[model samples]
Target: MTTPLRSLFDFNGGVKPDYHKDASTRLSIGVLSAPTEVPTELVIPLHQSIGGTPRPIVAVGEQVKKGQRIGDADGDVSSAVHASTSGTVSAIEMRRMPHPSGLSSLCVVLETDGRDEWIACQAFDHKLATPQEIRDYLRDCGVVGLGGAVFPTHLKLNADRQGGIETLIINGAECEPYITCDDMLMRERANDIVRGVVLMREILGAKQVRIGIEDNKPEAIAAMQVAVGDCGDDLQVVVVPTRYPAGGAKQLIRVITGIEVPHGKRSIDYDVQCFNVATALAIYEAIGLGRPLISRIVTVAGNVDAPRNFDVLIGTPIKKIIAACSPLPDTNRLIMGGPMMGVEMPGDEVPVVKATNCILLGSNKIFPPPAPEMPCIRCGECALACPADLQPLELYWFSRAKIFGKAQEYHLFDCIECGCCSYVCPSNIPLVDYYRFAKSEIWAREKEKSLADEARDRFEFRQFRDVRDEQEKSARLAARAAAAAAAKQLATTDTVAIPNTEASTEANEKAALIAAAIARAREQQVTATPQNMQQLSAEQLAEISAIEARRAEIREQAKPHLPPDA
Candidate 1:
């Protein structure tokens, strides 16, 4: 059985703005039919969530089924992207995104085949799956928080790191003015939301589940009460006072649980975690029907003849949504969300992504130009209206002077950019704009510093490598020279006399010649030519004369032949 409602708590500061929610929530959510004049092509940006951009898996000209995975999750922090309807992949290229910055991102453009066919899907039972398995399943289903932040839902469900979660705070407090998507969702699908909440309670193993909805949404409150009563769980629907910025995660946590999450500390550190009502319903859809997050309910309001909400596909252009609403002829500005925290679109041609909850069309009639910014009068009104209990005036001064460090020290990032300070500023100063500029500058400088640090690391490593290489080269050369020296020393020490290879070879040749000459001298006897004639026998002397005669004859013959030839 569910427990009684807990005592409500008050946050630091908040404002009561003119709630323009009735204009859109008066009627039930409208179902948009397929475009008749032209085929509605969905341009799903890969970076719909708050983490890394998903990689495109479907290429141009490839056929994709409705609910088919077109983009795969990039990392643990990212969510997957699926086709909104069965279609042919037309173009996977850069297209204008639905962000206030007016920059482009990689988008998968799919032209609907008009059949709205579906791929085979299997429903999942959370009881049968492990915690990690459920998380992986949610990641693959492209489920994320639909509450403006669009953070991946799987990461939020990781309670094991938090020493086990104590409570699960469901934020149904749609406190932002003119945003009725969540309010209407709770009213129409309260049972589904309760089921999703139960699933979350099971996932977190929390002692209790408290859904914080603003008291302003009575219909939603009644519907949720009925659903919870029927479910018979300890899910308590706590009604919080409707105030601007009460829907913020930390603020909602405080109002519901009476715990102020300190700056730089996550809510889970306090044994608590939070999720949005719309995000819960998305979780239910993902697990119950195996459906991926391809579409969402967008509230189209402000300066329109028929301000209503529509169940829009993920990639429908804002222009088509405005056309459906019959926007006023004087409409000049198209904002992607509520006026308090919404981003003004550069043009209506941008496609809606997961973070888009409201498309507020405004003109001079609805949102007149702001009063000229004046010098700060040192009034404390901005600080009084700040929900985070920050000194807006001090933040403004630091941000205006580009002194981002001081602004951060004053908890500028905790400001939430809720525009409460700006709304209450008497000087009409765009205090939120200054804060945003300061934050952006700080981020850019941090990025630059990070890159510089990486470059320095690489340079230092290169220098170390060069020194090591030089030392190695010197060592190798020294080793070679030492080896040669050792060889010479060994040769000198091992031999009695070092053999002079060239001199020894020459001496041996000379000795060999002398020996041969000596041998020839010993083998033959010689005598003087005049004295030897007396010693010669008569026959021998005659033979010698005959021999001389033969030699003279041969010489005459040779001389005649040689002269004739010449």
Candidate 2:
């Protein structure tokens, strides 16, 4: 077994609040009960992870089996999309995404056949595969961090540029209130988690492995300890203090590894890398069973009769998942994640995806609407509770005034939107909301600037090309003129050197022919002038008027057959 860590480090700024984890973790994870009116359609968003959205591989009307690959990774930093259940591809179109903005994106609609059949998967022993081969296999398996970030796991594994990792920290802290998916996974599948940790250790070539779980989860810590006993002396379970936002990657990393991840830098840059417990479990399944990630255990809690966790398929509708919990009659809001970081769903029809860990049903009684935001009193409670050590009041002032540059200057992008600041604010100011707005505004302006730069570049290039073309045209004309002059000079020189009677006669004949041709062309050309009009007689003018009248009549007659104006 891995020797236990002799000591641990600590980070600054955190709060203690009601965990409410027991409501869901009291029971074991179970499969979701199919609703009486099972949803016939499932909208599977391709861009669930943090990179390029997976490209659709299956077309409409194509039959797909459970765990079948439906969308392929589009880039190195992307994850694959799989069929959560056997169904026929009905539509691949834009649908509302699960975000606060409620924007639309490309989603694969599957009409369930209700068979839930499985497609054959090529499960390989990860121990037998090379590290590179295993990484590629995990990428195909659609493995990603299930700790709400949903970042691709393959990219995280490959972040170690020097191939020398000091520690691999597994974040099992689950510090967010009402989130126990990781807590339960650690308790029930500790051995599997340990197995995944061992695999990660081997792949990363790290000297030590640390799984940090909060002290509130005594059972999970105990189970993980027992599991680690069976492994070698390279892995241990580090029980961290129970605090809100302690589960954050940076905070947990600092507490477990004594390393501070500098702003704009990654944890891997400091000789360490982190993964969630659920992510490690996914890695283990993908490597050990050759199974692609199709589903996850989601915790459904708050304002429900039976609040519990269920093994939910990825594309199952949120309405159906909540049906299992029997929401209270007063339930009005359905949040897709925990209260701190969760986004309220536009409707129940939104489907579950990789990042969905909790579906919280909030009633007026459970989560009453926030009190009218009071003016900030500069109490400094928000700053004291902020895990990132940022000034929430200052950010609020800047964001409220739309002074985005000032907000950014205070390191606005570093705010994790963890809700710690908003939670402790005595003024009930929606501090996190302001931060989010500021960040989004900054990003929008940056995007606009980028687009403007691109347009300017294209316009400048066009101008350059036009000037270049004009210069080339002028050079070509000048060269042709010079050639003609040179030819004339050569002919003069030849004529001066040798004068023959036959040549002179030929030249005179050519000159006479050219003059006659020019005179004939001038005589045949028609020119309009007042002198020619005045020369016309009265009879000729009358004839011209008659011709104009006939032309106008013809034009009137052709109006019906003419094409309409654009």
Candidate 3:
């Protein structure tokens, strides 16, 4: 191993709780016996990573081999899920998840066939493969942060903005009480962990590597040091102080490099990144052995006769391990992590997931309920104990009043929810609970606002479309009206433009000659008829009148029924 650094830095605040890991670390990692005769089923959830949830590819009643891919990664930021043991998929339905919320999630229930078989698997040469190929292989093999964050490992293998990773920190502190999975992994599989670390360093182009383990685990530190022997001058094992949350990625980075990464910023931005020891082992197994992550080391301690670490299969029931650990009669509750940061599981039958690191069984004596939450006295102890170095009292007040904006202004998101402030609060206040509540409310409001904004945008677009359509319709109608008017005007102009025809002139000349002839006839009758009819008496005149009336009727009947122009 390289020479250790002489100086170490300290994070602002942290609490040293009683590390109950001694009981679990007493024995080496034990393997759970496979179900050979008994009918046991494993309920594995597909949504196990920090980003997109995977989609199940295996159907119900399908036969799946151990380490066979059951769920495919959904998108760029997801991890695949594999079957833990050779089994036939009996049912694919919603099952109770191993979360504090007691919510149900989609799961594949595989009934073991007692044949722990495997599909084809071939190791790959990482040195020859491209960087993208290595990352894709790890993602498909279900490699993730096994330290409980469950962040997909492939996504974290990228280079920083500065172009390369400067320091790669491996977290072996296992600072949480009652959790010995990482410690046991480092002690037993230190060589594999180093191989994974070297692989990561090669991919990231890191200049140096630092494996930070708490001074409390002498065995792990010694094992890691020997495994890292002369790998390179840049790789070294540095023992950090035995402090609570020293295993925190940020805290460990600060302790090793004295670079305090701000909230909402990534460690990679500072050319440093961190991973868990178990995660490194999983990575090596994926690349070196071509074996996907189908199982993990889990610590079962607290209120149990045999508090031991077991290499348990994924999707194993919590009750199975509890039964093996011999849970005391007084064990009344099951928590899936250390007391300080673990969560109370919904029930004992809940299936294990990738995020589960430890199963801390609890009883009334082990973890009694906290004293009634008293009003904040502003004693300032919580601030001093906070590793994030934020004022806990002010945050509590803002959260209690439901002033989420104020809480955010106070940098509430920086709180890692490590529970140090709550542990040291003299007012017996559950400050972490308040912070979580505020955060949830804020998220809900943001989601609602987004939905409202989207709906409004859609509505506005519809209105604009309607107005445009109406204008188009009006323009079409006006065009038709103008076309009709133009046609009428064109007809009138054509009539005026036409020259006079010969037939029209003949009809006009005939009408004029008829009118002149009638006028001359009337003048001759008035002058010459009086001399011939001087001696004619009244009887002759009467007879003439009767003949004239009959002649007038005949002439009117004989005349043609036509207009003067025709």
Candidate 4:
């Protein structure tokens, strides 16, 4: 009897293109020699993965070795970066990078010394390390998905253990056209890849390990089967049907295990964790040899005299790789990865980063200029091809209208920009491009909202301070009034008693002196100028006499309270 259809969920809507695998799959991967004209500058971007950017550790003019830690992972999600070669840091500044928009990114530049010496490194015993320890070690080694995603591998491995992950899915399906680095690795280093898979199984405590390879590469499948012959029944090698994007973690998981990772959910939720074959091999290199991820296998193809796969060091310029391949006569478009998901390079100055898997130097003869884009006809072809099961036409309309909120209602964020919809569209409309536009608009609005929230917080804090100050001022005033009232009451209650004999004698003498002085002053004033006397009205003269009389009375009263000597 024939074997059952291997792939469980045969999701429809994928293109069958001329996969030029023979270009690099047949040739053994060769180690690229360091260029004689070593670049004085190396632009190493900080954000080489999906999570937080690594923090740079080296300063300008600092000397470093090939494996020296130039940048460190800031958090559990981030990945570290090691020096690709022994060199002095030339500059740490922003430069053009390998991105779709050709945006500038902060990069670390190095001037090579041609020594290629390694720094002191340490290897950890995988058997002795705890799950957390293994995760941290892998992160420090800068192990990310060698597949185009560049997701931190440690983050995927350290997913919730309580979820009870039972299966480890190893993706060996190099489905992208004109890419064969994974195929070469599987054919040559199957044993190392299996060892890496075993190590991951041990770290995750998985029950079964399933190695999925496309049927197109029978040689790789047979090679891997022989390598894992004695690995026991727990490790099984299965041949899956050849399908584009079958290597996607979610798609591969669904195809092999019939379990779909829910929207906004992880593969661990389905009791499965997927890892790339290259990533597995890198893990083996990291744990077994104590070597950090400073280089990777790159497939250089497309319109060249010779197409080959090379284990190229990180930070090697794209121009150098093309020159090594013997420059193409008619270069049309140069992309850093597969044409399906790769980005076009503005120039050849951009360096090969950790995510650089394949470099395609397309010629005009091989890849003709794309036809002019026409308006969408709303034929629903894009929606049918969307792997995420989204309405691409609606998203396209909302995105063109700049209505990001409405676009999000239809799950704009879920679009992976796989270009499957655009590929299948009859009108040749760039549907994924519209989705990207909506996503960026939403992100910009969110950033603005965050700034507004901060400003509001500062205003509220200022108002609170003003209210506190006013309350404190009122409290101080009340305290001062209470103290003054208490002092007044004390003064009124505490009185001095006067002796009767001394009081009478003191009063009599003061009255006599005052009477005599008043009589003399009155006589002198009457004989003086009549003008001065006339200037004083009847009310003024009466008021002055009353003040003089009151002063004499006060003196008489105080004399009784004074001592006998006074």
- Give the best candidate by TM-score: 1
TM-score of each: 0.85, 0.84, 0.83, 0.81
Model 1 Cα lDDT, one tens digit per residue, 164-270: 57889999999999999999999999999998888888778888788999989999999999999998787888889999889999999989888998889999889
Report every candidate's CA lDDT.
Answer: 0.87, 0.85, 0.87, 0.81
TM-score of predicted structure 1: 0.85
RMSD of every prediction: 17.0, 11.7, 19.6, 15.7
Tell me the tens digit of each residue's lDDT in model 2 across 1-566: 54354787887788887778888988888776243333678888998898898999999999998789999998788999998788899999999877767788899999988877778876677567666776778788899999999999998876335665988999999988888889888889998888888878777888878889999999999999989897655687888888888899999999988898988899987888999999988988887677789888899998898888888888788888788888899999888889898889888888889999999999989888999999999999988888888888899999999999899888898898999889998889999889888898899999999999999999999999999999999998667555554454466675655345766645644554566568778876644344667888899999988998999999999887746763
Alpha carbon lDDT of residue 327, candidate 3?
91
Q: What is the alpha-carbon lDDT of model 4 when measured against the actual structure? A: 0.81
Better of 1 and 4 by TM-score: 1
The 10 consecutive residues of candidate 4 with the worst lDDT sum are 1-10
For model 4, what is the alpha-carbon lDDT of residue 120? 73
lDDT of 3 by residue, 1-566 (tens): 55554699999889999988789899888887455522388999999988888999999989999999999998879999999989899998999999889999999999998888888888878778776787788889999999898999999976333556889999998898889998898899888899888877877888888899999999998889888894554678999999998989999999999999997898987889999989988888887789999889999999999999988889989898888888999888899988988989999999878999999999999999788988788889999999988998899999999999999999998988999999999889989999999999998999999999999999999999999999999998667555544454466565654235767434544443465468789888776675666788999988988998999999999999899799
lDDT of model 3, residue 351? 81
Report the CA-based lDDT of candidate 3 relative to the real structure: 0.87
Stretches of candidate 2 off by over 4 Å are 2-5, 33-40, 124-136, 480-492, 496-566
